[model samples]
Target chain A: MRHIRITAVVIKELIQLKRDPRSLVMIAMIPLIVMLLFGVGYGGGTGKISIAVVNLDKGSLSWTVLDSIMKTPSVYVKAYANSIEEGRELVKDGTVSATVVIPEGFTEELMKGASTQVLVIVDESITTISSTIRNAMLAVTYKFQQELVRSVGGSSVELIYSSVYGPKVTNLEAFTPLVIGIVLQLVPTSLISIAICKEKERGTFEQLIMSPISRYDIIFGKLLAFFIATIADMLITLMVAVWIFDVSVRGPLIDAMVVSTLFLLGSLGLGMLISVLSRNQLQANQAAIFIFIPALLFSGALMPIDMLSPSARILANLTPMYYFVSAFRDIMIKGFGLWQITWEVFALSVYMVLMMVTAPLVLRLRVD
Target chain B: MEYAIEISGLTKKFGDFVAVDNLDLRVRVGEIFGFLGPNGAGKTTTIRMMCGLMRQSKGTIRIYGYSIPEERSELIKITGYMAQRFSLYEDLSVYENMEFFGKLYGLNGEGLHKRIRELLEFLDLEDVKDRLAGRLSGGMKQRLALGVALIHRPKLLVLDEPTAGVDPPIRRAFWEYLRGLNKEGTTILVTTHYMDEAENCDRIGLMNKGRLIAEGTPKELKRRIFGGDLVEVVLQGRIQGDVIKGFLNVGDLKYKDGETVLRLVLKDASKELPSLLKRLDSMGLKVQSAEPINVTLEEVFIELVTKSEARVRGEAY
Candidate 1:
């Protein structure tokens, strides 16, 4: 751990990275582009689901249900069809996500206080959109029943709901921490994963290891350089999240940054391990994706870890990202303090330490 | 004699393949020792083992009294290595590369800057100090690699094929620098396949198939292959080749120029030639002219490699 040797390597790394504009642009743009994609794609709440409507009943009660479905904020009536066949055609041809049909004699059956069914046809190929459409139609039916009861002068009970996060939390806001977790996890990991392998590929590793520096110096030096270079990535991700998308951070922003820094170091450490293990840049890139895709999928970045099977949950727990995403969510959305997220922070620290230590230990100082 | 590098029974293997085998060598202090071999002859492997860039599978290496792998840190301080390929950071400026390597050897501040300045001037790289190494011409890059290797003023400099692909003039100039470095008392161990270049070494070791087939001064290797130096003579008068062969010292004899010219192998050309000419004068045979024939290292290298291969084949049978 001689400071002078480490400083020398760090300075050399910085100069090389600075001179390579392509890598610099990639570091900045990856986070920006990924965040923008998430913000624009999922940010506006799944973008106005379109469905077709078919009214077969002779009474005006069917139009009331249609009006309620159209009034729901996320639902859009794309077309009106004369028969269930035509409505089904619209859904099959992908003209709309689903079709809502009112059965014949529906208002007559309701007036006699008898059970009636309204049919909804949906395209199940696009599962998310189809499920959303189904939920919207269910809500429309529930509302219509409640109104019918109120008109008859019977007492109606209102179903009220509450959330730990405020009721106004948008989809984008709730998912902001997940986006940050992803940006911090994959971007830095991908960037630093090729550091050592690139040197080895260029034939410079032979010269570098010939110097008097130790294995710790090389590993830690790269860690410091990549950390300085990519901390900007994290900042840009947060800025886009907060200023542009208006993602609210309920707790102190600095606390979120501290947690983010821990996660960032862990990612860099993981990448360093990969870099040391790989013999070439292509191998390093593939290995980075190999490890991170699993982390992204199982670590609750896209879905809750609890939703996974019990054995899969064990895999999620193994990923440092799960704890970071969970902790970031608590800090940003739930307003939890550092004291509440100590376990997450401790787990991240342990991961970072393990990787950072293992990298140098596994790194053979010889090119052969 | 004090040796800059000492090795015995050095062996290196990759899984089941042997790269360097059962090697023994010593490079004397403050002299240029050239390790010469064809491609894949284990020249680079031997250099790597000596410089501690690789670990030998068996045997011992001591550079300047520091045992390798155990005392590699100490060895690193006193040794500078220039790999066969240009391995400096190409993206870095010439000055930055030197500065980085200089600092790695624990050089810093004014002292480090002073050493870098001296090396830049010495290697004639001051003008391109700010140029990126990747942008330099082949010759300049070679010079810069040498400069980086010499930055710390090491006691020993190990170079692996420093002039493999450079043109002739640059190769000559590079040797001049190496000679200059040697004059300053930096023991050099360089490896190359160029036969002419090995002539510049104070001592030469010819390796083929992971074995040091021959080792000596350039002159000694030539004499060893031919059994003696070749000397050609012409006599004007009638002289049977047998008469001269009987008078000559321990040697081989061949005739040319219509029986007047005789080529003979002598124990020592410079010493034996005068007496042979005197013997012809004493025998009433007028001597026309005589000169020692020069033997190129290329011939010696080929002969030695061919003989060693034959021996190996014979043993295999």
Candidate 2:
């Protein structure tokens, strides 16, 4: 292992990075794009949902409850026609994603110590947000119940609800980290894999083999460039997220970088491994895209992994992105420290070490 | 100098197919050695084996007293290999390509810069030091590739068809540079399909069907090829008698052309030519020209390979 071999590989890799403009842009744009997707797409904060209020309740109690719900930032009431059909149409036409129907005499039932039902109409297809609104209404009901008991000289009433897990948030800050992680996972791996394919396409790989540089040196050189590029993207994306989306990255900023870089190492190693096994550029791209598209889907970056089946959950954890997504969520949204995500960090580190360590053996230079 | 490369029973196989078989070659250091074969004749395989780029299935290769595969790094340290298609970082500048090789060879700082500057001028690529290699003409690119190979000042240069595509003038210029390198103590093992190019080698190894059938100096190969000399005689008029047969007994003789011309193969071509010439003159045939034209490597090579191929296939020549 001559010292020159490492330097030569590194310098050559840098030159290759400079030559490939597409990879350069992919690296620089991915993280920023993820952040923008996070900021604009996810981070605006999921409070103040629009609800068409079909107020058939001709009493003060229902009106007061509706007012309290609106004040809680849980739901904003838009007056619709008293007809139930119009309320259904509001939900159907998406003039409102949801609507609440208050029956007549709803407030008087309370005075008579009678139970009154509040008919709520909503689109079930918007499941996450529908559930979020459901939870907010329940909390408002709970508060109402507590206030009613106080008003009635401390006579507590039992309330029934089917769902658990309170809705504390609804917008982009919670998902920014996941988006960033997903973009981070995708860009470096795909770019580096494609770059390796380009070498095979151009026949520069033969020159690389004949040179004194070893396999490890070549792999390392490529990984370093990709890692750097991805990290740069990750930083730009994080900044945009912070400023534009208001998805403040919590915990140590450097730790965010550490997690992003390590995740990239795992992903790029997987890509390079694919590139090494692939005979041509098209195959390499297919393999990389296969990994990346599924990763973005199953990484639990958008929807909750909890919604998936047990086997799907297991498969989700099998991906390196799952750990990174978990790390980002915990750090950026949950505002957890390094110790809080020690397990996620450990999982990511293990994946990265395994992928990078075994990549060399997988990418054999078959001159025979 | 003693033989720089001594290979015996060298054979290379790809899984089941034998690419080079039982090849034996000996080339002296400081002498230009040529390996001649048609396309796919295992010329590249042999050169690659010598460079330690490939391992032989069976054989022993000793380059300047170092065993290969185990000592590939050692050989690669001092041996510059110019591949069939000379490779370079086409994106990098001419000087940058040289500096990269120099650094890889462990020359740095002023020494590296000085050597690069010298090679720049030597290859006549001075003004284009900053120009990308891909932008250069075919001849200039070849020169740049050569300069990169010479950056380490290798003792041996394994050039696989270094002059395959350059125009005749540039090829001539390239060979002159190569000869200059050989004079400065570089052992060059070169492969070319052109027989005229083979004539420049001090000794040549003629390969066919994965075997080296003949190996000797240009003169020795000629002598061995015919087991004698090649004499050419042309006359002003045609002749048909024992008078032509009385020309030479030293070797086989044949007359051709509209006039009676004969090529005589003999052991002592120089000593026999004048006697044969005088004999032709006395025979009352007006001689147009007479000379002892030695067999070209092409003749020697065709004789050896065709005979070998015929023998292997049991064909009558």
Candidate 3:
């Protein structure tokens, strides 16, 4: 409650911030890297793709289809292997995003007026990408089948391929900013909190408490140092997206900084909250991870909120990451303005307020 | 003299355990009062409550007549504490540590600089002024902790187990420094398990299980504990308890620490020493040397703790 007491702690924290550079870079650099990983990663997807080839009947007609595939962009070619497991491993290791195996008796089947099936091995780790790619692959397979039937003088056979989501989006760009947001939010909240917890574990909290500073001063002091580090990292991640990955930051620069700073408050508040709850570094770490991981995963970061059941979707809205991702993507990708993100700011403010209100009450007198 | 610290019926309970029971204590202005007890005897807890670091479950603590928890902020203005461990910035240099704490007390500019300079010179820590506190020796660390506590020049200073690990010579030096502070009218309340340290205090508080069993001047406690003077005789071999009693011409005799120890009336002392020595020699006893010394804080501790425990069991002794 004392003004000087709180301010004194704030100054001491600044000195500590000046000394530790690694934490500074972590806050600034980590977000930028995550941004690029999401930007180039998700931005590169174009459309559904499939590959079909006829080795024996690969006469003129097969070459025409092959040439179109080589020339065509978006639909990636799935290299055929001798065994299905070999193809499956390729998908497993992400060597090939998806694989299409062409049947060996293709030429004979066409001559005998019988149909052959082409199997698509998809890596569902990214179910959206996998399903979209699978559809493109199956479409190519049907095209190849129809062409072979005409060449062999037989009746055309229609193919049956099913999709869980109809008319999927070819430009599935939404996941990138969401993933990047999740990582950025997760690291600062958990790692910085861990850093604070480490100070507690090492008995440095005693030093801080015994010093002439007050609790608010100490809390505000740490917040400044951590904020600088986080801002630097955010800038780095943003730069990588703009320069390297070509992901646009369509929002106003000042607006982005404001959002990042407010989000930083919310994140740091979460960190401080974890710090106050756990007495030791390990316990604090476990607690931080518990709070961070679920917030990121269930906060509609990696997957769509619609895919989650109604209850989980509602719960995801409660997390700060949900608003952050929504607002960040709106600003970066969707080009939404500050007025549209009013709710995100409101949510973050609430998070920050709750943390500011509760964290100090848990500020321990001593480990004993 | 005015009381710098006053606590009455101060009780601290966590769940079902009482760390500090209903206790009352007053520290006179500018007096070095020592609180002595073994570990886990609630010394630190009591100090913390007095400082307003921890809220007391019951009773009132007034620091400079400012009621605690209510006047905690004002109380913080005038109080400085050095934790049990040498709790200072271990990574920071001694100079940096002082400056940071100086800022905490709302000190700045030339006034802060002068105060810091005085502290460095007073503690003899000028030579290693820039050395990291982590690398300092136990004695040097103790000095630095004390210096940091004195940086703000608070009227009352409380130290919890300040020198639990420092050697004898350094401890003697630390006590001398504390006495110097007291002479300048800075009241100090320090806790220790070592009985010898309690002797340096103007008055002492003997605490056991959250209660102040006894409190008085060192001389008064010693006289009351012994009811007379303790006669200590240094010997080569350990004296048997029964043999010691038989050799005594006056009151009870007891053997302790490989020496024949007994308390007797001062009037019988001169006559008893010769006859006791002769009797030992006649019995072919190898008496290395013999001298009667004064009752010490160690004896007073034993006298009080033993009696207090016996009283708790309702045994009349």
Q: For each candidate in the order shown, give its overall lDDT on alpha carbons.
A: 0.88, 0.77, 0.73
Clashing pairs in 1: none
Report per-candidate DockQ: 0.75, 0.28, 0.29
i-RMSD per candidate, Å: 1.5, 2.7, 3.4
Q: Please list, in the order the candidates appear, how each scores on TM-score for chain B only.
A: 0.95, 0.89, 0.81
Candidate 2 lDDT by residue in tens digits, B1-317: 48789899999988787889998888888989999888999998988787776778899999888887677667767787777875787888898778777776778789999999988888899999999888999899889878888888888888889889789899889989998898888989899998888888988888888988788877888888677767676777666656655535434334556676666676787887777667767867788887778567787788888888878888553
lDDT, model 2, position A357:
82
State the lDDT of candidate 2 residue by residue for A1-368, as single tens digits: 36666676567667767876876777776666656655665454555678887788777788777777787666787656678898999888877867777788887898888898877787888787798789877877888878777886566766675642223544565566667777776777777776555665665555555556567877887777667656677677777776765556656777877887778788888888887777787888788888887687778876679989998888898877878988877776666777888888899989888888887887655344
Ranking by lDDT: 1, 2, 3
- Minimal lDDT window, size 10, model 3 chain A: A164-173
RMSD of 3: 7.6
Rank candidates, TM-score, best first: 1, 2, 3
Q: Backbone clash tally for model 1?
A: 0
Alpha-carbon shift of residue B241 in model 2 (angstroms): 2.5
**What TM-score does prediction 1 earn?**
0.96
Model 1 ranges off by over 4 Å: A44-46, B249-259
* TM-scores for every predicted model: 0.96, 0.84, 0.78
**CA displacement after TM-score superposition, residue A194 of candidate 3 (Å):** 4.3
Index of the highest-TM-score prediction: 1
| lDDT by residue (tens digit), candidate 3, B233-273 | 55556666666555354355556666655444433346667
